[model samples]
Target: MTVTATRSRAGVLTGVLTAALVCTGLMAGIFFAFTVSVMPGLHETDDRTFVTAMRGINAAIENGLFGLVFVGALGFTGLAAVLLARSGRRAAAWWAGAAAVLYLLVLILTMGVEVPLNDQLARAGDDFARARHDFEGVWVPVNDLRTVLTALALACLGPALAKRTAGVSR
Candidate 1:
């Protein structure tokens, strides 16, 4: 490759990697917040209050800014994987690939498990007791799993970013 083209690729990759890191970090932070604060605080509330508060949170989370970061983390990580592999940076590729897979799992868990549960609870309307009974036990465990996955994904991306930076500096 020409020097200019190589520099261009490096520049784009730096942006992608930076986005991957920030987005994954933010996503992980969200899960951490829920785990350490939101859920625990919800635990102290009554059934109706818990159900209502959770419903609001679920609804609020589907906005534009959240959507951008949520999907951005996945997209950038996946791109980083392909780019690293193409450049024969196998170790960095593997790290980024793992990050992609783990983050994708987070998406799957959210869509397949969490969203449906949230929807059901929101539609429960006056059935707050039933909602709390059905949602809390199942949802909490799955959310915890996603939280761990996000954190792991970020960990993988950290190594990938370091490797990418080293390459560029060289």
Candidate 2:
């Protein structure tokens, strides 16, 4: 390949990796906030208030902006891994790959556990106590797990981005 083409490809890879890092960090922050602040604050509220607030949050968080970052973290990280591997930066690629896997786990837990619980809460009628009982027990722990996974994913991306930069410098 021509020198210009190689440089262009590297630049694109860098952009994708940077995006992956940002999205992953944003996701981590979100989950961390829920873990440290939101859930705990809600936990102190009355059962009816907790159920109402959680249901509202679940509804509000389904917007386009959130979805972009939610899905983008995985997509960009996976693409960066493929691009880095293709460019012969295997070590960096592996790191990116690991980030992708970690984020995938977060996604799996969200879909498999969190979403269903949220749905049940939404349909829970006026039995706020029972709804809170059913939801909080499962949701809080799963969200904590997601928080950790997303943080780990963000951590992996740091080294991957650093390695990519070092490769460029070399």
Candidate 3:
């Protein structure tokens, strides 16, 4: 390949990688913020609000729509990491890879633990009594796992991107 072609590829790779990191960071932040901000209300209430919130959350979880978005993000993030590796930024690529692994873990926890539970609850429909706190109690820790890991993944990306782009101008 010509020098110009190589340089162009590197530039495109860097931009795309940067965008992926930023997107992941934004998504993680949004996820963390929304959960933290709303969970207290969900837990503290015995009124319709709790059920309403659960309905909203459950609606999001029921058909695995959010899961699809997460899966897509994972795909793009993985591709971005691969591109970084190809550009000789092994450390950044590895860091991104690690973050991706953690993200995947979050997905697995959702699919393995949360999704099935959600499915059961959805099937219960109106019959699911408000007295039952089993879902909330059980999912608190599972959701916490996802939140913490996603936050860590977002935290790690900053340094990774910095190292990767240390000598390159945006």
Candidate 1 lDDT (Cα, 0 to 1): 0.91
Scored by lDDT, model 3 comes in at: 0.69
Q: How close is candidate 3 to the true structure, as a TM-score?
A: 0.79
Strongest candidate by lDDT? 2
- Pitting candidate 1 against candidate 2, the one with the higher TM-score is 2
lDDT of 1 by residue, 30-49 (tens): 99899889998998999989
lDDT of 2 by residue, 6-31 (tens): 88988998999999999999999999
**Each model's lDDT:** 0.91, 0.94, 0.69
Model 1 steric clash pairs: none
**Every model's TM-score:** 0.95, 0.96, 0.79
Q: What would the per-residue lDDT of candidate 3 be over residues 68-152, giving only the tens digit for each residue?
A: 5567556666776787777677777887788778777877887899777666655555544542365767676787777888787
Instruction: Name the runs in model 2 displaced over 4 angstroms.
Output: 166-170
Q: Candidate 1: deviation at residue 48, Å?
A: 1.2
